[model samples]
Target: MQNMGGIFGILGVGCGLYIFYALYKLKSTGDITSSILLPKDVNPKTCKDKDGYIKAVAPKMAILGISTIIYGLMDLCETFVMSTGNFFWIVLVLVFVVLIWFSVTVSKLNKTYF
Candidate 1:
């Protein structure tokens, strides 16, 4: 049981980082369009190029939220019994990093997917 918790924590961290990397790539390598999936700069400031940045951000944000919720579940499952010990920081950092990773990934993904 203890080992499972530790493994889950590490898995959370890894998943988070992978998602972030994917988003970063999306933001940097995509073609610009007037879709709400990416930032305004990709759409240009002209009327024909106008895209609702806020609208584009919704889906990506939702994905990030989903990721965070998953991460919280991972933490809760791991912490159910062994709530204290030397591995506290591992669990703490893992959860927090999961959030940061997903947020970054989502931001970039929104531009591409929206």
Candidate 2:
């Protein structure tokens, strides 16, 4: 149980950092050909305005990444300070909510732009 928290924390923080770096590169380079969160079927070439689309999506993804790190931190808290009951379930549910919210938001963006 304790080990799981450490693993979740490390992986979540790493993924969040990677998301930030990728968004930076994407925005800096005007390269929207790929995305870590977006579906591959979301053709960048089909976007009405490439820069506009990137601007819209980057923030959403950044939010998701930040929430992921938060979830990870919550897991770490469970491992260290909190007990393994309500806090754990709460964090898990929150993470899933964040993920679903992100997904819905991105889908809306896709429909608007692509």
Candidate 3:
């Protein structure tokens, strides 16, 4: 179980970096609208300019990526702290809570922006 925490931490970091890279690509190409799966009520045509669309989406992407990175760091810290035989369960709970919060935030952003 302890080793698994480290693995998850590494995976989270990798996933977060990939998300950041995708956001960078979208911003550079000025094609954020096409990259996301927008809701039915939200039409891409509503966004008149490519720059504005990218600008709107970039912050959400950044928030998601940063939260993921923070989760990863917390996971790594939990792994080490567990080895010391202290506050293991508390840290684990915190990780799950953070993960849930991140998911909910992303879902809301998807509905609002995408």
lDDT of each: 0.50, 0.76, 0.64
Residues 3-60, candidate 2, lDDT per residue (tens digit)? 5648887787787787778788778986663566457777667778777788888888
Q: Give all TM-scores, in the order shown.
A: 0.36, 0.76, 0.58
Model 1, position 53, has a per-residue lDDT of 41
Least accurate 10 contiguous residues by lDDT in model 2: 30-39
Q: Best-fitting candidate, measured by TM-score?
A: 2
Higher-TM-score candidate of 1 and 3: 3
What local lDDT does model 1 show for residue 83? 56
| Candidate 3 positional error at 46, Å | 11
How are the candidates ranked when ordered by lDDT, highest leading?
Answer: 2, 3, 1
Better of 1 and 2 by TM-score: 2
The residue-by-residue lDDT of candidate 3 on 1-114, one tens digit each, is: 674758887886787787788887887765443434354566655555556556655776776677667667667777765453445456546556755765576556555554
lDDT of 1 by residue, 4-113 (tens): 55567456556555555544543554323333234555433332322344345434644654564466455655567445554555645655675576457746655454
Worst 10 residues of 3 by lDDT: 30-39
Q: Point out the worst 10-residue segment of candidate 1 by lDDT.
A: 43-52
Q: What's model 3's TM-score?
A: 0.58
